[model samples]
Target: MKFSATKSTLVYALQIVQKAVSPRNPVPTLSGILFKTGADQLTVSATDLDLTIECTVPVTVHEPGNIVLPARYITELARRLPDVPILIETLTAGSAATISYGQSQSNIHGFPADQYPELPELPEAPALLISQGKLKEVIRQVIFAASTDETRPVFTGALLEIRDGALTLVATDTHRLAWCRLPVQADEIISIIVPGKTFTEMLKITGNSEEEDVTVYVSQSHVFFVTSVMQISSRVIAGKFPPYQQVIPREFSTRIKAVTRELLEATERASLLITEGMPVVHFNLEKDACVLSVHTEAGWIREEMDLQVEGEPLQISFNSRYLCDALRAINSNEVLINMTGPLSAAVIRCPENTQYLSLLLPAQPKPARSE
Candidate 1:
């Protein structure tokens, strides 16, 4: 195969598909990127069995063929080339690929494209067009809460629940939870768990393009995200996501409204004084103010901040990191925190925006609770 393309275009295509390359992959082909030239476009693809990313770019194709090249070597070669046209050709023997641009040339050993695993066929599920901006936002808000532990495989995915024309994304790590809802149209009601890694990669590739809508295809075992120049597919997680609704309390004994930024800052300060193994922050809430304090054998910190409270005063304890994660996920000016009991989970949300909700597990009480 022979092709001529500017270094900038080749570099961009390489970067877009490189996310699927796995360093420790059992299949050597999975560690390389597949390049195919046909008509006037150059297609690049990479896969780790679970997820596949393919991106295409315009090119000048002199010969139509395909070759698999080492991802790291090819990507670096294109990235370092001057901003000029690059010529690439696979030898008649299909043993190596010659890359040349601006008087610099390099040859890298190549693998036959036939050895690469067959790309998975697209699922038969119906596809729906959804706003890219909203889809990107929901992914950012929920992906962080997904469990990294492999113990509970189901919790490692983000649950996409579609019912009555409403789409909600929920993720939980047993310690914290994040939920985001959006209005969408669906021909059939369905709920599926897509791998957290898939969404994370999609976030890295997609941008804030308000003009285009991402097409999402869901099936029993797979899901697909298609864009103008790229396609991403992954095996969906099979199993039931925990019943998150039941865990969220219906009512609360205390409610406090505080500026999200201010509270996040206080938590960050208090976390410094707490030890690594035990990073607990105490929340003391009164009628119109709140105090966040942390005490350890190393040091102690006390921070008093104003809050808008409803109902009687209350005090609670939680891991400062959990609180910070929840607060950072909440993109709002003020947050309303609902507490049912000291031992129960605390739910937080923006009073005006019902689309997002986060739950943080309270810390275990010490022998003597903090005042």
Candidate 2:
């Protein structure tokens, strides 16, 4: 292969595909990036057998061929190279390649193109069209609650369900759950479990504007996300998502409406004061206000935020970290808190929009140490 591309354009494509490069996989080509030169563009691809990323950029192609070079070396070299066109050429017979820049040149041995794994072929199904901005927002709202424990495979990813015209995404870690719903036009009912890691990477490539649409293609085993210049494909997690509807609280004993930012700030401060053993923040919902406090060996925290209170008064304790995460995800000025009891599942939602909500299983904090 032989190609020359501007440093800026070349570095961008390399950096985008480098995320899928295997760190130390047994397959040599998996750790490298496959570079294919075409008429006037360079197509870069990398895969770790599970997730694959490919990006294309305009470049000057002297010869149309393919090679696989170390992702780490190529990306780092392109990033540090001077602002000039860089050239890469491979030998006719051997796996030898040379990178040329102004007054400098370096040689790197590459793997034969045949050794690289092939990208998955998309099924001939209708593509689901969705606004890139809406998808990005929904993924951020729920993906953080996904379980990181790999032992329980179902809980490690988010449940993606599309029925009628509503698209719902739900994620849970046993202790807490977060869900969001969006409306879209769909011809078929679709339900699948998408790995949270894949959605996290999708956020990086998808544009934040609602004008652009992302075409989603689902095969029997793999899901593909395609944009104008990029593509991301991942294997679907093969498991049934839990029945998440049973856990959402429909009744409440006490309801509090407070400013989202105020509560988030208080929870962050309380989290800092909490110790390793006592990771709880006690919420004392009194008349007309909510008081947040946490008692630890280091000190004590007591913050009061005023809001509209309804129903009965109650006190509940929850993991400070969990509470902070839920609060930060809410994209609203005013948040509604519905408490069933001290030990029951407490719900948090935006007052204006009912599409998103989070549930937290209250925690028992250790008692205050001796003064």
TM-score, per-candidate, Cα-based: 0.95, 0.95
TM-score of 1: 0.95
List residue ranges in candidate 2 displaced over 4 A. Answer: 206-210, 365-371
Clashing pairs in 2: none
Model 1 has an lDDT value of 0.87
Rate residue 145 of model 2 by lDDT: 93
lDDT of 1 at 304: 92
Q: Choose the strongest candidate by lDDT.
A: 1
Query: Please, what are the lDDT tens digits per residue for candidate 2 over residues 69-107?
Result: 988788988899999778989999637689899989989
- What residue runs in model 1 are displaced by over 4 Å at the alpha carbon? 124-126, 206-210, 369-371
Backbone steric clashes in candidate 2, count: 0
- Candidate 2, after superposition: displacement of residue 8 in Å? 1.0
lDDT, candidates in the order shown: 0.87, 0.86
